[model samples]
Target: MSIYLCISGIVFSVYLIANLWAMSSNRLNQPGYVLTDLDGLVGVRHNSLSRLFSGFTTLVAKQHIRRIQVSSECLTLFTDADDCVNIWLSDRYLPINANYAKVLFPQAEFVDSPFLP
Candidate 1:
């Protein structure tokens, strides 16, 4: 009986330690879609029109912007059918302000807008 009790105590301790470690190291996967901790969208009429983005889907904002900046460079650029909105990227991979982050693949542009799609 003592032996059984000792073995159970050790197993419980190991399990608790493993769970704590996982939490500390963030090994636990979060649900996809969490975006940011910034203020939500605001409108003139004070209408609720935005959802909080969070979780694993935050990868959407994880762009590897390197070397150049679009605001500094006026280089004209285009998007693919998927409209991932890549960097303007001149011949030398220079950055351009294509503003692909805000624009969905074909959200506003495809909706009879003179500026896009």
Candidate 2:
């Protein structure tokens, strides 16, 4: 496994420890993740995959590595019902993001996403 996977695992594990174990405060007040701001999400298409991957890694680390009151993780950074998503990528690896997207949709239309948001 890569260091990124290790880092993510550590983060969720710690969250389980503090929350499920009741060793810490309410998770809503001390979220393990954060929502990246609109600025961070805007024009996210880096010139290279390595750059995009590295940037995402940094963002995740910055968000989950800390224990804060306001987690961007609680925020929904994007609602692209009116946008055209042109992901010009050669490979795919969104880690836990697929779960988020799948949970957000339930057999939704693909060709014409009238409710993409």
Candidate 3:
């Protein structure tokens, strides 16, 4: 039982370390959409695990965005079809200027969304 607990602790620690490293790296800004053009229907590409895991299924097949919506806690991008990408403001992948998202997406409806703890 002690050995099992030790192994579990090690695994958990590794997971936390990896997540922190990824977050501190700022990998999301590598390549993809710009905040200014997002409202104009420009597509943003992000491959970060933090942002990707937020709503991966909706965005996996979407390459182009037709609409952008910003709430207090999340940013949702819609494809031309029915797909969408959702990014939580609390995620490290999110740009520091995330507050500007609301200004860029003025028509976006405000809603309650999930955030990282």
Candidate 4:
């Protein structure tokens, strides 16, 4: 009975340690994990599958990005051919810094962006 209790205690301790490690991980702070101003207008999160497709697109991609526009709550990337990708700000990520945005996206225009404080 005593040996069984010791084994259970060890198992519980291991589970607690693992849970804490996962909770404190910095995965969300990475470039592709959470959108940040540092990524500029061209940065998009890439998983394994998306990374493969992105490589192919970069190889034969002819579309040229014209400008990026930031509004109070959304970011818009414009291409020379009228194509665009929009990202909306939410509670999922922290607010963006204005200085980084300007530095990263030199061609970007802003319109009363609340996130750029």
Q: Given candidate 1, what's the lDDT at residue 98?
A: 32
User: Model 4, range 1-117, lDDT digits (tens) per residue?
Assistant: 999999999999987775444333455223343333333234443222232233422211223445656665455556667676554433223234223334455555544445655
- List TM-score per model, in order: 0.25, 0.20, 0.45, 0.38
Which segments of candidate 4 are over 4 A away from where they belong? Answer: 1-41, 46-63, 91-94, 97-99, 113-117
Q: Write the per-residue lDDT of candidate 1 for residues 1-117, one digit (tens) a residue.
A: 999999999999987776445333321211111112122321110001111112212122222211211332122212333333222222221211133322322232322223332
Which candidate should be chosen as best, given lDDT against the real structure? 3
Where does candidate 2 stray beyond 4 Å?
1-36, 39-43, 46-83, 94-117
lDDT of 3 by residue, 1-64 (tens): 9999999999999878765664455544322332324333433333335443534322232234
Give the whole-model CA lDDT for all candidates, comma-separated.
0.27, 0.29, 0.48, 0.44
Residue 22 shift from truth in candidate 4, angstroms? 14
In the predicted model 4, the residue pairs found to clash are: none
Model 4: ten consecutive residues of lowest lDDT: 54-63
Which stretch of 10 consecutive residues in model 3 shows the poorest summed lDDT? 54-63
Ranking of candidates on TM-score, top first: 3, 4, 1, 2
Which is superior by TM-score, 1 or 4?
A: 4
Which model scores highest in TM-score?
3
Decide which is better by TM-score, 1 or 3.
3
